[model samples]
Target: MSRFTSICLGFILMMVSCDERDSNPTFSHDIAKIIYHNCSPCHRPNQIGHFNLLTYTDVKTNANKILYTVKNRLMPPWPADPHYTSFVGEKVLTEKEVGLIETWVKQSCPVGDSSQIPALPTFPIGSMLGTPDLHIPVKPIRLQGNYTDRFLVIKVPFEVPRDSFVSMVEFVPGNTKVVHHVNGDLVRFEFDKKKDVYDGSLVDNLVWDSTIRLVYKKIGLLHDDGSYPTLARSVVNYLPGVIAQKYPEGIGGWKVNRKSAFVLADIHYGPTVDDVWDSSYINIFYAKSIPKRPLQEFQLGTLGVSSIVPPLIIAPDKISTYHSSCTITNDISILTINPHMHLLGKSFWAYALTPEHDTIRLIKIPHWDFNWQNFYTFKKMLKIPAGSTIYIEGVFDNTRDNPYNPNNPPKEVHDNNGSMRTTDEMFQFIITYLPYEEGDENISLE
Candidate 1:
């Protein structure tokens, strides 16, 4: 063979080998390593996540679902701007890692070798450890197989010799698989007939009626007596993905008077009611000694809006804005901020401007997810100067492209009150902070 021909043939063979290697379906250690590091924290046994992804078979069975969720940036849901600051336990997938999973799924999800699998990551069983100071469980109730929202009120009873304070709290779902989301409220008034309260309350009449089926509905129920609604003077909410937040020093604890009655109800939403959920519980943590600080949550904007036109409509390729503001009177430490919106919400950004016009970016959720929203807690205390103005802006999309749009024809909606309807939208911003003084109370903008 001629020297030139031999050289060209050898080069072509090398090129073919490289292309074959790149296209191969073989799993790399890198792929398994990333999953173990990022997903196993909550996706393991006895955890809040619905499924376990510890083994190769576990990942293979749910391969396509995993890819779709990750590519869409839905699962391991962390809502923060990656460019600004990264959190300690943030769950974001890199481009290369996402591509690797997509390629592996297309290549038949090959399990290269059992021995090559890395050890699953470990996470501490927080708040769940040790016996709870108090546990409140709801009565067992059968969810009717109809499309409706159910509101239930359960009253929890506790006997306190003196005023007590709460430091930490946890809401442990009896059936994490079925409970969509639960909200906790502190009610000082006690009812003699709890069942009647559940049946006749305004919330029950509005949510639990039998008219609508699959579209939207709510159920109302309360907790039982042996378990008192876990009471805390300072901390008002406790749920998974919510962290242990403390107030600034010298703020002191919340006041829970002795012999005072409390009610803790769970607002349960069943997208599709297939199973019967009877026993759900929430645990409350109390400190042996009261701390120098107390946590307080302030509602910055108006609770209801009055608009002549529907405020929340967004047409195809069109943009709409929702604005709300809150004013601060005294210097304080902001522990966390939560932004709430209905299905049409797209993006949210919030900032605080001092009286001098200097601004501080509190938080920004670039892509909003209604299902996984929570109070974004700051790692360190954020001190806001006294007399600051807080501003929030949220954008919504109402066109057909928006999968969450409630309306079909896309009509213009404006009403006197800022209540959400076919054509209207509502806006709200909640901030949790501690007043600078020991006995300083919250001053609301509304």
Candidate 2:
């Protein structure tokens, strides 16, 4: 054949191959696995997802919506920027995968071979950390349909047969819709200090009064002899998309007294229009052995060890940025970090600089979504040198243009002395770590 004729045939073949490739992609073979693995975990029954994405019909119905969100990087809400640093269980889709979904949706969501569709994955029923040694039920809370947020201090009392070492404390929200977040502390009473661990009233409404002593007394947190019991802060926490934080065996576990209680220092439930009841619970997993290196934690900014550089105040109709930093006095292996902000949050970032001037990227959320705050765990332990300085920057948009701004005219907002109210602003970076060990840098947190 002549050179021009040969070139014409090659071009024809290439065009045919491209057409075949576009036509062959289908829902059963191409899209099921992605949704099953990434979206279904939250989109199924009794989850935070608004609707089910479990079947072919469901995908077909929402194909356009799904395509739009993936294109905009909205759905499967992972706030951590993968480019800055990666964490375990990241749900980000690749550019290629996003293109495939786009093409499939554009082609009318073909179901080429229904038989080839992968089976729906099975998820744990109650607890994500497997069977628990003890299950402590949180007292059920009733909420009115007045569209007002409720903050409650609750005590979940329990008595184990004997003092036991616990590796993990898992908080499972019974009402995913209304339950916003939880911060729990462990209260251990001396075996002989109190006759009954269950004698106190279970709950107290924080809105009525927030006086420390009165709240404690109203909730029956004091012992029979009118003395304070041992309290461990941040034993368990819960947010919308957060998986329970479980470290490797013997890394971080706390001992529970025979007579103990799990005090939810404050549990926030979002405003609802319909009256509902929430019955969240806690699961305790016994440790195989005592913790070899107990986990320690500290925070930067807004009532933490470090203070916000320009203070956390945000003026109405304005955008502002604030910074905070803290120097590490001791070498530590950092496990997990949680960046916290409220409705007005725009962006967040954190990093550490060593004395040698080497920069260590910790986490960066270029666009902040208040609904999906998470405790981001590192894939492996991150070692910060003793002289390293960790810095954090947060941006808040209080202008009317900001859709999430709670105020219509965008009134002034600030961290009201580390207030828990959603409308009030807060900038905090909480780090959980352990003193550095010989091979700590090589340890995997997964």
Candidate 3:
């Protein structure tokens, strides 16, 4: 064989190898984009996620775990049944995307040209709603991390002149690991801001009634007694997989008043992390003017859900199914929906029945996961005519099959049980809606 022929043949083999690597997804162009956008949000350091997937080294080291979790629909953690209803904050990967990941991993996870990698998408240190109009900080909530669960209800006050509207509200946790989720109620009271800053201190203060005591309860806000107060209202929420909620333009917002506006955050601590401290803040995005329609939030559930026995209670070593319903008295447009359950929950279904008895499927999670649940905004606003009754049904498994049940021997569980212990269970769903108008069906909270 001629020497020239040998050199040409060797060149051809090297070119083929390079071409195969180029055609496939490289760490720079394909995989990095996917990881940065989808996985890195919670996977970064100091976040709730157990591991970081921020860089090529970080992801490549855990490539197999990533493949298994994403392929099994476990990593991104969106549990809403996509066939029943589509939502706004969905993070599920497409089949094609998942396929690409599998193929890339099978190719021994090759790294391509570094220059092709794009700049990492920036995330705010705390609030996702950029440059909040108001920054109201809550007093540092200290958690000893010794209990199964801890509940802290603190009021962080903000001021308004007359009446205003806010479009976005975000809760930033102090310790993400120790904090499970936070729910806040926006309440207002009559306070002369010109007179005092309401620094949230109770020591050596004369205005105890104006500061610590309950003030102006909003007209629709519900009290513990189940009565609608005139001044306090449900404002915002954060869950394991859920973050901040931003409303659509010119359509939905929460109204605030000058009288005395404060946020009551009902923070629930999940597991104990030694030296846990949770000092969170709420950032508000104020609209220049009132929106076309105001967003209202309602917590709907059944009395049996809170009961320690019968349908509401989970009998030890057995599976239980419970049902709850609420009828709509007025025409409304639903913006979002979120179902809440504890560790032993198995499944959940929520639907609406119109006055004519036409059934509208709202959401269905055949396999309910407590840690991954969030407020799922509808792709478009859902219109339910007046006199429609919405029903929610859930199934709970209290047996040993459920690994998350804290009970070593699987004991009977009750709701709240007058404490935040994990032994209890809860059954409820929250809906964000606005009063239906002529073009209600046309409005989209995308």
What digit string (tens of lDDT, one per residue) describes model 1 on residues 269-327? 54445655546655656666777656677664435222212344445455587776767
lDDT scores of the candidates, listed in order: 0.58, 0.88, 0.71
TM-score per model over all chains: 0.70, 0.91, 0.80
Tens-place lDDT per residue, model 3, 408-443, is 799887764323333467787888888887786776
Q: Which regions in candidate 3 have their CA more than 4 angstroms from the true location?
A: 1-23, 145-149, 160-163, 191-232, 259-265, 270-273, 303-310, 355-358, 416-422
Which candidate gets the maximum lDDT versus the true structure? 2
Worst 10 residues of 1 by lDDT: 208-217
User: What are the RMSD figures for all models against the true structure?
Assistant: 9.6, 4.3, 8.0
Please report the TM-score between candidate 2 and the true structure. Answer: 0.91
* 1 versus 3: better lDDT goes to: 3
| Candidate that scores best on TM-score | 2
User: Local error of candidate 3 at 158, Å?
Assistant: 3.6
Against the true structure, candidate 1 reaches a TM-score of 0.70
